[model samples]
Target chain A: MTNETGAPLLDVSGVTLRYKTPGALITATERVSFAVNRSDRFVLLGPSGCGKSTLLKAVGGYLKPSEGSITILGRKVMEPGPDRMMVFQEFDQLLPWKTVLENVMFPLLDARNLSRKEAEEKARHYIDKVSLTRALHSYPHTLSGGMKQRVAIARGMAMEPDILLMDEPFAALDALTRRTCQDELLQLWEETRFTVMFVTHSINEAIKIGNRILLLSPHPGRVKAEVVDVDTASPTDGSAGQLEKEIHDMLFSQEEAH
Target chain B: MSSKARIVMRPLEDAGSGEVERELSFLEKAWDNSGVRKVAIILALALIWELYGRWTDNALLFPPLSDTFAALIDNIRSGVLPARAWTSLKILLMGYAAGIVMAGILTIAAINTRLGSDFLETMTAMLSPLPAIALLPLALLWFGLGNGSLVFILIHSVLWPVALNTHSGFRAVSTTLRMVGRNYGLKGFAFIRKILIPAAFPSILAGLKIGWAFAWRTLVAAELVFGVSSGQGGLGWFIFENRNLLEIPSVFAGLLTVILIGLIVENLIFRTIERRTVLRWGLQS
Candidate 1:
């Protein structure tokens, strides 16, 4: 699949993101470059301060890179658009006032220009995909944390964007629920083969979810290495453990050196 | 898996294992009901007021609860108190509606632009602390002693709290929610209507409640002065007139009517809105 790629679906090149704090100009990521092909389950794996989430935000067009460019399907992303839908880590990402169905349907009606009936039909399809059909009328607050995340996923998938951007999507869930959610996400990907740029600090999650994983270094995040053929590293097997240990050593060895 | 010693276990009791449904005692049931508790409190307060009035035995200063009730019933029958209350309510509604509309515009402005936000902050800081009643003399001079003057002061009282609360509410909206709204390409008024308004509704409802209380009291106070000059006013005028005539029971009745109106608005109007929107949406308790 890597050799078969043609001009990669989304190209992010040498992007640097910085923001001004009270007293200092903090760099979130510096000169990070990567390409996500069509239907690629691309994962950004790093420590908490590595700014993988910031890169995802830049890709989502919520933040502009201080240098370099991010282009989706040959167009530079200048601002947030419906082409890239994001499933946020925070449970409050789903509109509290909207029921599960409405939350999913909102972007469709708002940006996709679909008729109300069409939006509802499309929304219900995605909602059912997430196995939240029974909770179609329930508000976000009424749902459990895992259920809320599912609803958020449903809302994002309903948009059917060029690429889905996820920022530590299941990071807030309980351990058991998190595993189930990760499995569900993989199952959904298997069915649809939708391109996703998933950001996570968990090694297991990165290996399990991404076919290609980009390892990043801590603070002022820079691309450390890129690991390919991750889809072959099954989590239950010895190779997955070996891969996990390799990624961990690469991430923490710099800290020891410093 | 067989052990050396055999253990005997009792079968689980199905009846006791499930949830138990037991009827509450009559007094316990009554106390548990909110409406019943509220009514009980009101009755207890009425009893205390009656006892105190009787103990004092000064009808001119403090009419007994029973005498006040009689006067209230008499005025209702005569259509005097009803007319006065209706007049006050009409002016109050006008002012409240105008104030809310203006506050909405100001809040939208504050959310959209830096200058508008600064303007709102400055205006609220400068004007919110100034009592609406204090503006009555200027209002009287500008709008004359009528409904116009009364509404002017009412707007003054209602506008600031509503604007300030709404602005704060908008500012407090979660970053994630804002990003979601922007991700959908929602801009300006549509953004406010869809994301900001519902997200900020609980605080906005609080603002509405504060604004209502301020507007109600300001109207009454403004009417007191307005009645003296205009020769026609609302509930405040009714109370002042009765006081002049030395009809202490009627004066107490007028004051009771003011409290009744306040209770009706707070419980009926605002509570219904809160229940339908904020509470139902789980934005507030």
Candidate 2:
């Protein structure tokens, strides 16, 4: 069964992702490598043209790697499964027809084989964790962008997946709301300690959210370096600002070299 | 103008608690009612019809509104109109249901495969614009002189619009939503039923409406033609008979019946569905 107790929860080794355009085939990621241990807050930090999101999608099993492999719990990723739940950046990720409660319960019922009552109870718990119990019945369209993201988070988290893939989830929010969401996410992480692979371009966000960060260079993304122990950075200690500056320089120097 | 201007700062005046609500005037209230407005418009049209018919003074050509109403009541009393209406409705439903099922199958196939999509697109382009009645002669020759012929034409009328709208609706579903569905391990028919159907419902409903309208008109026209060679038929046949017997008011009554049925289906059935699904879902205002 190749069951290794010490195997990383997610092991993405030299993975390459190629996608088709109208007239061309483009490599989105080239030999990008990273490993996420159990309960690791892994962040993929890069510029807009970088394939961080694409890499995350590959790990989510939405996109198959053209080269190398992504193994989760010693099993190769073949396709999207409940084990790797993804929360997309777009607010439209939440089903417009389903209320917040139903959105959270959908996967619980579909993949987890939960009864309706069980699903509802689990959904409510997650909704409460996201502080959205009052908005349980609200449709996605009626909610603010921040609220929609929370519902999406609740939906993803409720699945109790092995890993959660977040593709710049709070990127579209206003700065203030983005900060609040980031804080809420960290608080939620503190409670559940679930592993998450967050992809974002914001250096500050990467520093704030990631305990382990993998920096990728843009235009067919390639891994530049890995920053470990980001959790040591705190606002009071000024390490957060130092780490933010370090990330900025890393990206800037890589861009200059390119 | 001076480079530096003097600035004045003052405390803001206290605005009254707030203007929370206002009572609408009678005219505004009445005008705000969609049903009232539609009824008024219908009454106005009836008034115009009566005035025009009376001025023409040619009952054989154009019956007045009151005479048409009387004919409608008389036909109902005799049970002929209801019987004819039922016959037409029953046939229409049979064709409509068949068309919906076919459209659903085709659209689902199209979503699942590239070749199926091309097939749907090509078939819709070729057949959708070709008037369904234009195929009635061919339908008649193939199916013989009966409900079969009418049903074939009705199917042709209903199938294309439903397929086109539903296919396009399925296509228009957002990539993010599709990913979310798949992220939950939803695939095949489960993916379609859970994600695609609801996401594309507004477009699907629109297609249904267009198909119904086309089917209804085609049914009436096909019936009128059928009366030329066949025995008994629906409202169209009633109108044809009334015209042959020089009962002009009864013809008007038959025409009125068709319009009323269309209105009822559109307003009651479709509107109710729209309110319950898409409107409540905030897909449409």
Interface RMSD of each: 0.8, 0.7
Per-model TM-score on C-alpha atoms: 0.94, 0.95
Prediction 1 global C-alpha lDDT: 0.91
Provide the overall lDDT of each model, using Cα atoms, as 2-decimal numbers: 0.91, 0.92
Clashing pairs in 1: none
Q: Residue A137 in candidate 2 has what lDDT? A: 94
Error of 1 at A257 (Å): 1.1
lDDT of 2 by residue, A1-258 (tens): 234677788998989999999999999989987789888999999898789988988888888998999999888999999999899899888898889999899899989999999999999999999999999998888999999999999988999989999999999999999999999999999999999999999999998999999999877889999999999999888989988888898799856875
Q: In DockQ, how does model 2 score against the reference complex? A: 0.88
